[model samples]
Target: MAKKEVLRLENVSFSYAGKKEKAVDGTSLVFREGEFAGIIGAVGSGKSTLLYCCNGLVPKEIRGKFAGTVRLFGKDVAKIGFPEISREASMVFQDPNDQIFNLTVEEEVAFGLLNRGMAREEALAAARKAVARVGLSEKLHDDPSELSAGQKQKVAIACALAADSKIILLDEPVSSLDWRSSQEVYAILSGLAHEGKTVIATEQDTCLLSRHATRIIVIDGGKVVKDGGVEVLSSSLIEKLGLRPPGPMSCGARK
Candidate 1:
């Protein structure tokens, strides 16, 4: 069966307030259900900004000179309400601290669901199921503040799951985690993709990105330089973009 198209961007371009150069320039792409896509680029390469465009954060929340069209779930994002767009495309920010605010992990997970009109008991029940999906069932009642960086990141993911979002967008999710913790987060994301979520993440580490993401997208200077399977991470062009190409073992091992 053909995968459903979850996201589509056509000639999308945006420059932040007071920015001379476009953070995203004439970028076009399509994402489908069950794809664990990695957007890899060097710092200031516009990968993060590209993710922002997925859920209407580019021209809506963050004011800028924006051009082009972004379609979420086949509907133009410009025509959809921000709240409606957010439910389909849930964003996990770089810092878990930014997403975690409620006292208990369960509450943090249920926050978005409740805001979207899910009943109290039902949301908490969904929260438990979502937390377990990320292997954090035991941490449900614990304070999010007391959890480790990776666990907090898991909670952020669980929040998205509880809301029943089909598309998950993350920005450098493991940037603050230890090597082992980063591995765990990547594994969780891959599992989510297998479970039918269209998972898209922005990361600077090509090695880690290559290890997990089913597809690799290269972003440079606010544009998509390349887009294809995991093999692209091993390309010489990756080196020309000022980013390290993955080692032979990793390149050989990633699907």
Candidate 2:
């Protein structure tokens, strides 16, 4: 049987207002269910922009000269609009501060479900389950502002989980986390993938990504330069595009 394509971008391109070039240029890619795909590139390589496009944040929140198409589960996102698109796709920003606004951890997670019209009791139940999934159960009633940076990120992820989104887009999920925190976060994300959720994360750490991501997508200069299995980490194009080569002990170490 063939894998189900949960997200698809076809010749997609987006140029910000007054910007000379596209932030995401003629990029076309398909992501299937149960995929733990990583997007890696240097600072200005458009990794985040590409991720935003997946969930309709590009043409919606950030205005630009957009072209081509982005679809979720075979439906065009342009027609669905962000409010509707978000029902199946959830996004976790790099900074947890940008996502968590509720009073407590549970409330933060429950917010999405409640907005979607889930019953209060059912939303709370789902929120607790999602919190436990991210290993933040202990902080269920704790203030979101008081948690550690890593814990905050987990709460952000928990929100996505509670929504039962088919696809999760994380932008530099662990960029602000410590080493151990990063590992923990990745473990949660990997678990979600195994549970049949499409997890797409963008990160600058090639070593970490190589170890955890089932597939890698290399974006540079607003375009996808490479897209394949872990072997793409060994491509000279990665280094040529200003991305660090896989670490000495990386799973993608050249054989």
Candidate 3:
């Protein structure tokens, strides 16, 4: 079966407030459904800025001069507000602590649904199911404030799921997690991709991405450098690109 188009960017560029250089240079690309696209690049390469553009953060709340078009679900992001775009393209930031705030895991996951006017009991039930999907069902009543870094990240993902987000955008999701935790988070993302959601993430861990992401996109100097399958993570190219070699190309890479 052919995948459907989910996002398209046309000659997009953005310069942050007071910044001389464009954070996101003229870049264009298309993303399709059921794809776990892993974005990699050197520091300050505009990986995060590109994600912001997809969800209408750039030139919106961030207040920057943006050029070109970023379309989500065939709608111009610049033409809509965050609340409208966010429902389809939910963003998960680098720091889980920055995103989580509810007392219990259940409440944290249910926050978005409740905000959208879902009934309290129904929202909680949805939250429970979302939490279970992330393998954190046992911690439903536990305090998100005290959970491990990895667990907190899972709860954040659950919040996206409960909100029924179709495109999950993650920024350095596992930068603070250990090896095992990073693997677990990528595994969950792989599963989500398999279930037909578009999962895009900025990651420093190429090994984890090599094992899970269906597509690999490398960015540098605010533009896409290389974009392809696991083969793009080859040791030679990885070295040339200043990215950590992900060792052997794991056979587990999603199709």
TM per prediction: 0.95, 0.95, 0.94
* lDDT: worst 10-residue window of model 3: 246-255
How good is model 1 by TM-score? 0.95
- How far residue 4's Cα lies from its native spot in candidate 1, in Å, is 1.7
Clashing pairs in 1: none
Residue 5 of model 2, lDDT score: 93
lDDT of 3 by residue, 1-255 (tens): 778999999999999888889989999999999999999988889999998888888878888889999999999998987777878988899999998989999999988888777899999999999999999999999999899999999999888888888899999999999878887888888888999999999987888887888788898889998889877887476777678877655434443
Which 10 consecutive residues of model 2 have the lowest summed lDDT? 246-255
Model 2, residue 37: displacement in angstroms?
0.9
Deviation in Å, model 1, residue 152 alpha carbon:
1.0
232: Cα error in model 2, Å: 0.9
What is the per-residue lDDT of model 1 for residues 104-167, given as tens digits with 9 covering 90 to 100? 9999999988888889999999999999988999899999999988889889888888878899
Model 3's alpha-carbon lDDT is: 0.88
How well is each residue in 136-205 modelled by candidate 2, as lDDT tens digits? 8899999999999999999998888888888999999999998889888888888888899999999987
Decide which is better by TM-score, 1 or 3. 1
Give the whole-model CA lDDT for all candidates, comma-separated.
0.89, 0.89, 0.88
